[model samples]
Target: MKLKELEQLKNEGVDHISSIERRRFLKLGFLVTGVYLGGKALSLAPLTEAQAAEVVPPKGKYSYSPHYSMVIRERLCINCELCVEACNGTNDVPSYGYRTDILERRRAIVDDKYETIFMPVLCNHCNRPPCVRVCPTTATWKDETTGIVKMNPGRCIGCKTCMTACPYNARYFKEEGRFVDKCNFCYDTLLSKGAKETACVTACPADVRVFGDLADTNSRVYELLHTPETLVWVLRPKTGALPNVYYTNA
Candidate 1:
């Protein structure tokens, strides 16, 4: 309240603030200093992460016809790796690489307790796929009808540009095929043959992987994401990839 105390406080300039820095502030409530440069500037209340990120697209705005997607029931995964096995068998994935993987994390729970969490990871099949954008060869692309990110090995040229651009680290170079490969939701082996689910979905013993057409109102994926009070999230949302893969515990 004193004049001297107010004078000692320094102003934090708005210049050079990165998007990531702004996102951090968006996640919590904070007062922001405002500047007016001949135009109106509004200072609004802080937004929660979900509101700020707009993680889920609005209804009727789906880009693909079928809007193929997968939902991972994160808590249900037990690291059995049956899904991995099935993917390898179905896709003929080499030993040194994987189209899907399971990751483990330990979280602190009630007093002095830790719980192990297993996460199933694969290509997210982003609506704004970085891989597709960076590929000079047009080897990898998102299927317009199904929304699956697919690869044409013949045109790949083994450049690995797509591999670097992928935020999820989902693609890997196949020594035998001499090209980059990633999960395509089993579009080639199963889905293209009129299969309802991907190999991983069928092999998951814990029912962790749920695959369906998100655009269909009657589909389970749409129901899971729209259910009241359920928290649905995607990995690397900060990347602005708009991934189709979602995760939920409910």
Candidate 2:
């Protein structure tokens, strides 16, 4: 069967499963297992050299100048939610909305003992952002200087196309402001004000979040990316966004 067929079957299975079973299955890490099985099903068809080469980027195809990126140290997140508070205060975010948030995943570590992983999520600031592509008024765009995905509230038409386009559920409608809102890595509020880092990064006591320029080789983000034997990944890689935000245990 094709990968799409497998995905259809997965969705069908999800629909048939009871809520409690689904929740229990997810807690036991069955979601990853199902995805792995789907990938294995797809591996039956091997790609040719030309087909594989199409996925590679050409030389000197850099998207942004500074290439601002963030690294999430997943193991360090303590779920204190200090970063969320800092973001709310720094950006004047309302109580009903959020620019960033944490999610919890449980995995069985021992007999009846489950360990929790706190995942912090935000706007990925993709190189080929779907949100930017779907914006009808060109209100949301990826910044050329810093590569951060930005929103122009004045230009927004309240269409919410960008909100639907985001796979990570990053964008939210700010009803009072009458526009879509999202995380821009604090470029306008902090970086433009001569701050070295974002409010969330500064507030993270566990040092879970690292924001820096990816284009600079001397930067800590560069060093982290170059580190050997480390697993670096992004959320929703299948979406083909090429996100700047990376997650790793190291």
Candidate 3:
């Protein structure tokens, strides 16, 4: 139904609603759950177990020719914050904001022993970027050639719509420029200058962050993701953003 027509419909009191109408509403609820909850919550998948490959794009099937991507080695992160410093310095990020940050988690290993895991996170540069979709002024968009979610600072009116749409919480409003800013994978700083790796990747002493073109099979990022027996995953996969950034301990 057209939005205007639906809006014009008289509100049927809940007590007077028909059974078929209730059923339709319930069906839609289930469909939404199945999509955002990966079908497991409602047991929508019955034939076979879901595979890791479901989240990953097929090999050699990258949408962009360069297909810029990153693979975070979860176990190698040490919380040194060098990567964070490099990113802020390279991108000219404000003191109150961060383009990337490290998250800490403690998990039991064996015999009452717990290990601290430091997780470094940044913008995923998703294939279906919600940020681009919600921007009212065409301030942000996903670059077609590099798959980088770029922002036109001058065009941003500080609406923060893209910030709300980002599932990873990657965007922040920049007070200096009076615009929203997020990670662009050092595109303007390094990639545009013929550099292969981002500032964060180069500054990481632990070698935790691997950045490269995923379209190249021989690239480190591709091997880390496609290697046998390695568990590759993304943050907030239920958002269906199809993020380019992957995580693994391989």
Using TM-score as the measure, what is the rank order of every candidate, best first?
1, 3, 2
- Residue-wise C-alpha lDDT for candidate 2, range 101-189, written one tens digit per residue: 99999999978999999999998888778898788788998776888889999999998889899999999999988999999999889
Give lDDT for model 3. Answer: 0.88
lDDT of 3 by residue, 1-250 (tens): 7756764677667657755676689999999987989755554342122123357788856878799999999999999999999999999999999999999999998999999999899999988788987898889988989999999999999989899999999999999999999999999999999999999999999999999999999998888888999899999998867888899998
Q: For every model shown, what is its TM-score relative to the native structure? A: 0.79, 0.76, 0.78
Candidate with better lDDT, 1 vs 2:
1
Identify the candidate with maximal lDDT: 3
**Model 1 regions more than 4 Å off:** 1-53
Clash count in backbone of candidate 1: 0
Clashes of each: 0, 0, 0
- True-vs-predicted CA distance for residue 128, candidate 2, Å: 0.8
The local distance difference test score of model 2 is 0.83
TM-score of 1: 0.79
Which of the two, 2 or 3, has more lDDT?
A: 3
Q: How accurate locally is residue 203 in candidate 3, as Cα lDDT from 0 to 100?
A: 97
Deviating ranges (above 4 Å) for candidate 3: 1-53
